[model samples]
Target: MRMYISPRAPKEVLDYAQAEANDSGRHANHAEGSCFPLSWNLPPGADLGEYEWVLNGFDTKDLPSINLVPVRRDEPWETIDAHLNRFGAEYLLGIMPTLWQLEVRFHAALRRSGIPVMMVPPINLASVPSLFAQFPIHTVLTPLRYLPELRTLLPSRDPHYMTILGPSDAPIECSPGGKVSQEVHLVPGMVALFQCETLAARPTTGFHPSDRFIWEWENDRLYVTDPAARFTRLMLPRHYTMREETCDCGRTLTLTEAV
Candidate 1:
């Protein structure tokens, strides 16, 4: 069986999902296939069955609208180039680990608009500088732990932007000539969305929650309830502490530490 989880309180998430479902003209129920109504909620400990599929965030209906290009780390440059040229790709998106393994010539080909997706511990800290020097990446997604190192590596005069991966209580140091923002990575067991774009307008040094999701702190852990999430509640897999102070960005988004 396939289950579709929708937020109960935030009407916008449900409304958006329903709109997409309606636009696609798919009418599958909770017990049926992938298409499900916004009113459906997953009961506590609901039996998802042995091989059930759960759809959330972007549903099957949203697939047609998204243009995704898949590239393998081992794929030859000629093959990747063919796909890029065939699709008329404007930019390349890849994980930091994969980008580092790719040939330098490949980096040069897509350096114009390549955006590297980074994660904590997954990305090799030592190779970052070489990647930056070889590929002129203007945008990056990384975690708070690497911010200081990244700040030191970035060119003083170049414009850069970053989207932080998770919560942190440590002060967010500014980049020499770049902007920093925050975002919650929707992992397998959890989903979260923060105001990443709004925070980009100014520099901030603490963690904050966006109005788009409900934030809860309990037992030294942070729980996020995203209105657009497929799961009811997602507990972040880290210890956290909430601080009720107004940030320099003029918003009381609160501060939290992810340890």
Candidate 2:
């Protein structure tokens, strides 16, 4: 699940899920969101070389229509050819900056890839109730580092933690541009991104409002606010990894950790 979730009440999501189950009365298991990112349902001992995680982008000018079946929109087809040609990409990762154009790009990307996408909405606009009348959420980013401070203030089950980055079943290196400069190995769990977007068109039972933080992506900061909704912004540097450190030329890898 992404760090930020829809602000709609959690119960509403449950009710929606209960009603959406198919003939089998089963809903698809939810994971993080991605547009054209590759997905994997690997079994133990399965060859990792069999799939690829495709990443792609599009312009806001031609956002397609994809409501119920966002994955069915027609793309130029050549868009993902590079990722496809590279091989084993069961996941499709898409980066979309426009909200009005999001649903369209998401649906088309989903349909074009025929796989699930990891959705990570920016929490840059996030704000938490202010503890001090004199200070603002904008001043809290660099100092707040653990979950206790968060739990005591926000009233949620998910607390904060140190971000540590490393490898998995295989030793994946997170940077190539110099380990310290490019590598950001965050600790386990999600990186809190406050200041999320407005009401999500679709709600899900997977997360609670208090459980996650919001982000103001454009500003690259986390937003916190007091009851008055005044703003306090914080930011944790985002972690990244290198291709060579992730998977071998013929291997598979999962881009996770403080994600």
Best by TM-score: 1
Candidate 1: give the clashing pairs.
Answer: none
- Model 2's lDDT to the true fold? 0.26
User: Least lDDT summed over 10 consecutive residues: which range in candidate 1?
Assistant: 66-75
- Each candidate's TM vs. the true structure? 0.38, 0.20
Across 12-99, the per-residue lDDT of candidate 2 in tens digits comes to 4434433443333632211111121222233457454532222221222223421111221232223233233433345443322334
User: Which regions of candidate 2 deviate over 4 angstroms?
Assistant: 1-73, 98-100, 124-259
TM-score, prediction 1: 0.38
Residue 65 lDDT in candidate 1: 29
Error of 1 at 162 (Å): 1.3
